[model samples]
Target: MATLLGAGPGIVAAGARRTMTRCDGLASVSSSSHGIERVYLSAEHARVNRTVAGWMREIGMTTRVDAAGNLVGRLERATPSGAPDLDAPALVVGSHLDTVPDAGRYDGVVGVLMGLEAVRMLREPGPDGTGWRSPLPFALEVIAFADEEGTRFGRALLGSSAVAGAWDPGWWSLADDGGTTLHEAFVAFGLDPARVGEAARRPEELVGYLEAHIEQGPELDERGESLAVVSSIASARRFQIVVEGEARHAGGTPYDRRRDALLGASEAALAVERVCRAEHHVIGTVGRLETFPGAVNVVPGEARLSLDLRGELDDARDRVWRSIEREVDTIMGRRGLRWRSAEVHRAPAVFCAPLLQDVVREGIVSTLDRGVDDPATIFSRAGHDAMAIGAVTDVGMLFLRNPDGISHHPDEEVSAGDVARGTRALAEAVLQLAADRG
Candidate 1:
């Protein structure tokens, strides 16, 4: 683990230090005055977009708000104005701006800022070393997606999915906790729902997509690695499960007469953990559970729970889901309860393109002083904008270590040193992709 070797690593690390400061500044624009709580189409979202767009303009990029509320900043080649009429395809770098309630400052925010910083470094003195910046072979665009958390609409990847041309008409009916449908919110936000398709990017409009993100798990932390190349985003399935049983008086109901829905649901959750732990590369979580008639003494009549299941492979994930389904059925049958489940979401696994994968790996390796030629590649159980963006272009990612692998919470962290190495690697990858394309 020698210090990063190439092209003013020290200076780049300083730039990363500034990106960290900018992350701190963005955290202040959250819904909660005390913590981060930005979401799609919120006043906070709009404010953050405006602020980030200003940062983009500082480095000579032209910024625009796309139809889906995504903040897009483009550095079009051969065009000093960064206007939209460039003939060159673009190399896209991006991550989401939205966050879950009480989110960590670095989950997706770090990537977006890192993209900006990486491009900033590349825009320095050109190949001839005679100018402040030289145009890249392909246009460069950094996007700050409005909603990858799906916290507002209960459907993830809205921004990137729209950019990928996968927008669903059914999403219009999706409502927020405040009773605002997505359509209504879009209109209120000054975006027309009818024009969301305008945000869709054609496949030929891009060279490829690259992102640098923090590892949301502890593998990198435990391995003591600064970065890992991403192998693929996981396949996922989510469900809303309900278990029904008759309500009975707490004191009068004997053990034999008792049919407690909470107990049944709890047992089902345990069964899910058991089944998933027994299998490799598969995991399941009961993230939410609620019992009807929540009373201290009343017997529960029904229980509702949320299941989030993911696996490295699609068939393996589906197989685990089927196993969980059967196990829950058995648990409820023995408990004298009726149960049912409805799938709320499903996203297939997305593998990285091999050439882009190699580029990221090489970029990471180059950052190391000379210790390792091959860095580890990780399978991402967490979904990303990359999962959606992969639909329209070759997409790849570099994962910076999150100390203790905690994310989606305030405790998530990545060191300035890791940030420096990460941005350098990300920029190098983009350069590699450009050269390869040429």
Candidate 2:
């Protein structure tokens, strides 16, 4: 058996370099008009999956495309005596392959590629001439989930949710920018929508889910840490808010006599920020706003806006929303404007399992054996596939430092060294889990 010392920094660094090369190659296959935009079931999606499948096959994994269009690569575990054990529950590792419009090269891509690298490190012989020192007790499955960005269908986590048996039938009616229904796109992509349920796995089928992603925030960079353990994923809710008033000529109508919907909406947006600021770890944003009859001389009789609220706790997020709603009511009442809001999306916070957290902590400590005994635990303000997978099994997350805390854009980046550290940490975590299970 190979010693842990054989998979040291040098070997890990080589693996990370390979991972970066693969990510760059995949980035070139995007379908973005401005930047990187590989959405669900698009031609780019198929191309990337083909490339990833090739990589998986090279590592001796059996690859398949799930009914929900997720790309899966399976490496069955073997007994200590080298006998294959096909019935073992899988230790799944992965992240979404889809991207937002004009996205950066890392984000979810790093997790998927790093996962493959970790498996490779485990399977290859170490420098000490020992082989398969830490054979996993469970099968290892790497998944490149299909639609976490929701760029094409406007519903995130479609791939992971399908795997968790949370597929919603109404999603078929969702339309894309090109007026194509999701159901039509599924058929066009050669995916049988009728068999989506086949993608769902029972709780007993999985040992757990683990993901390694770039820190989409500045916390890790500020702390000067290369990796950290995720404590929980934030809860989030979205709403479409509308304000209504009478229309008139902007120049002719007196300011005192006019009931402007745009003015009311502007005040409501500000109130959202103010209310969110009062609560700890809660955030609210008005990301989109538009005025009807957008002529220079016409008064904006109607205004539409979007609200996104998120918090570390479900009750806290709900409280902030209620406060914002009250503020909106006051703003509209004084302006003689009517207001209405429609909920668009909602997701509750998901906490990592304590056992999984310990394993991740050990992995981080083992990789970076500095005086750093305690790994930083950060709460994720962004949603992830782990949230959906949490429904079926325990979930854990490891975050690598993103230099500028920038993500979802072209400037997003991670250091090759940090990627190397993250890869080693994840591989160690898997080994630790195997030891615990045995």
Specify the highest-lDDT model's number.
2
**Local accuracy of candidate 1 as per-residue lDDT tens digits, 305-360:** 99999999999999999999899889899989999999999999999999989989
Candidate 2 lands at a TM-score of 0.97
Candidates in order, TM-scores: namely 0.95, 0.97
Q: Which residue pairs in candidate 1 have backbone atoms (N, alpha carbon, C) closer than 3 angstroms, thus clashing?
A: none
Model 1 C-alpha lDDT versus the unseen true structure: 0.89
Write down the lDDT of every candidate, Cα atoms only: 0.89, 0.91
Output the worst ten-in-a-row residue range by lDDT, candidate 2: 1-10
The digit string of per-residue lDDT tens for model 2 on 1-438 reads 222524756678888999999889888887866778899999999999999999999988999999999999999989877878988899999998899999999989999999998898887865755434457779999999999989898899999999999999999999999999999999999999999999999999999999999989999999999999999999999999999987899999999989898999999999998999899999998999999887888889999999999999999999999999899999999999999999999999999888888788888887766675788999999899999999999999999999879999899999999999889889888888888887
Best by TM-score: 2
